[model samples]
Target: MVIVKDERMSRKRTYLMCPPERFTVAYAINPWMDTSAPVDVELALKQWQLLRETLARLGHTVHVLPAQDGLPDMVYAANGAFTVDGTAFGARFRYPQRTAEAAAHRAFYEEQGTWAYVEPTEINEGEGDFAYLPDAYGGMILAGYGFRTEAVAHSHAQEALGRPAISLQLVDPRFYHLDVALAALDDGNIAYYPGAFSAGSQRILAQLFPDALLADEADALAFGLNLVSDGRNVVLNAEATGLAAKLTAAGYTPVLVELSELKKGGGSVKCCVAELRP
Candidate 1:
């Protein structure tokens, strides 16, 4: 099968991440989370560190978000805020357990004083629902809603980012966030799992990215779509063999990272990473 990819350039990006110092599965929120399951905090931290060091080795700048106690899921920093063109749109989680994580994002943005942080009035899970495609249609936001983020928050994000937002409805609870089912490979292309989206949303995606790489259910269940790409290189879970093959066929170098430990908290590479587009 031929994969039609539209690309011209790729650039190194600056990323924001939190140390998995206090990371654990102390509660059950998402389907992946099982409070009864044993969490190897040491392994989790090691995995997170590997992810960070891997990004750094790829010539990307990684900024650290100090982990706070009592907030184990804070390590999933992508849910904190969606920063685009230097402006930060903060998140308000649906579950109360993750609510305090938003304030931590607010503090990071405010304290850094680099980004024009906008505290949200609506309940939006930041990058969890918002995926920006810079080269697609001159840049747009693919926003998701159903389980975690509010649909109304799409307009707020559109207004904040100065980009048109295409609302996609996620039907599967496991793929609660857009980042879980769909990942923007770069600015022009994407790879997604259709089963995670509504039939209508799936149609929309197919029409939007006719040449997109598609992931099978096995790959999606492996957290394949929870990836971070720097145009040329894509970092994802090592378990996503199908996705890795698909990505490689699409002309992207798949960089597999061991992030299974963090999966206990219901996130992977993209979850621990927040791109700072300044």
Candidate 2:
């Protein structure tokens, strides 16, 4: 049976994002990124503008972070912080390449004055490895580890958010971040790639969401699972045809946006977005 919960419809949502001003494939961080691959800076900017316009058109508030000169990966703002109920749990990056972003993100939150920042003790990549489910699941945090985020950070997130955090370990390099492997839909359903997870993690997901929609390798590789959802409307990569069809069949409005230029840096729609809780 489809897990249906009391739909709490909120028309307005605040999203934190950073523009691709300094975006470039300067180094290889993930499997998808290649330093040799050329990135179209102008095209990436246009695509990002379109994404922000799309979100604004959907009746949501978009808060932008000024892209710093040295932090190219800051464009993928979802890695910044995990915000829940006006509290922001800061990120402690695993790689030195991204170490500069932690301070920038914290400063943005501090300047916004919307969320109370909680400094994280362990290495965590923020919302890239963290997701919040619908109220049916008690708005619990689905935390991923074994890549950018350490398992110990789950407790830090749980304590900061005052919500139960379920840990899931990622096994595949391609889906190193939870945002790329799994998406918690607004209607209490989950869309995920089973192969991206460890055997034990897959079992935990199955137990928690029996009727979750599964994505094939093709869809997953297309960054289909990396999407932003407002419970009813889903914004995702335009190339994710199979996943888009599945979302439509499941009664969601799939708004497609092309981010091929940004994908060279191993990011797409959801990667550029950080949901804000007030």
Candidate 3:
């Protein structure tokens, strides 16, 4: 049974995105990546542009982070940092290939001159593992570990962002990051696939968000939970029909966008966009 909530209010958001000019699958990190598979560079760029334009058309501000050469996965700006209330908690990627993207993220925030950027010591994948709920929920952060991020860094994030972070352990290799299996639908709600997490972590999620939407395995595999919500309008992968219907039932306007090309590198709508809560 799909859980439906009522009257979700909409809010405008600021997002960060990058062009997929340098995007390609040269190495395999996640299960989705295969060096043997072919990528259509033009298609990837087209999809990224549509995502950016759609967000802007929805009355949200979109910031472009220039794509650097040799960093194909740099288009996944959500992995760069977790920003809230003008403080940017920078990321330190686990793989050697993604490590340099961290410095570029830090530099972007530094150049902005308004944000207080924290230089990371722990190997955390920014918003990829850290999902922030605003101060309305006492500024709670749902942090995922056991894959891209470490449990110790939860404290580091808590200390740095001054927010309470609940640690969720990911067990499924495909849903390696919290964002892939769980989404912060709004400040007070979320949608997730239970199988992506450990048994204990599933219990934690249940206790915290009893009314949270649960995605079926099929939709979850479509990267449905890897979505960005501005409380009312949800931008997600086009193939996530089940999740999209559930969102509609719960009063959300699901704006479908195709990112199959980007998915070649293991990302979709949310992967290409980073939410900045001011």
- Which candidate ranks first by lDDT, i.e. highest? 3
Model 1, 127-162: lDDT tens digits are 899999888999989999999899999999899889
Whichever of 1 and 3 has more lDDT, that candidate is 3
Q: Highest TM-score, which number?
A: 3
> 122, model 1: CA deviation in Å?
1.0
Q: Which rank order by lDDT, best down to worst? A: 3, 1, 2
Cα-based lDDT at residue 17, candidate 3: 91
- Cα lDDT of model 2 by residue, 1-278, tens digit: 35223332434678999999999988887999999888899999999999999999999999999999888899999998998888999999998888999899999889877779999999999999999874747788999998899999999899999989999999999998999999977746689999999999999999999878889999999999999988878899999999999887776778999999998988888999999887
Candidate 1 weakest lDDT stretch, 10 residues: 1-10
Per-residue accuracy of model 3 over 103-175 as CA lDDT, tens digit each: 9989888898899998888899988999987733677999999888989989998998888989999999999
Q: Candidate 1: misplaced stretches above 4 Å?
A: 1-9
Please state every model's RMSD to the true fold in angstroms.
1.8, 2.1, 1.8
Each model's TM-score? Answer: 0.96, 0.95, 0.97
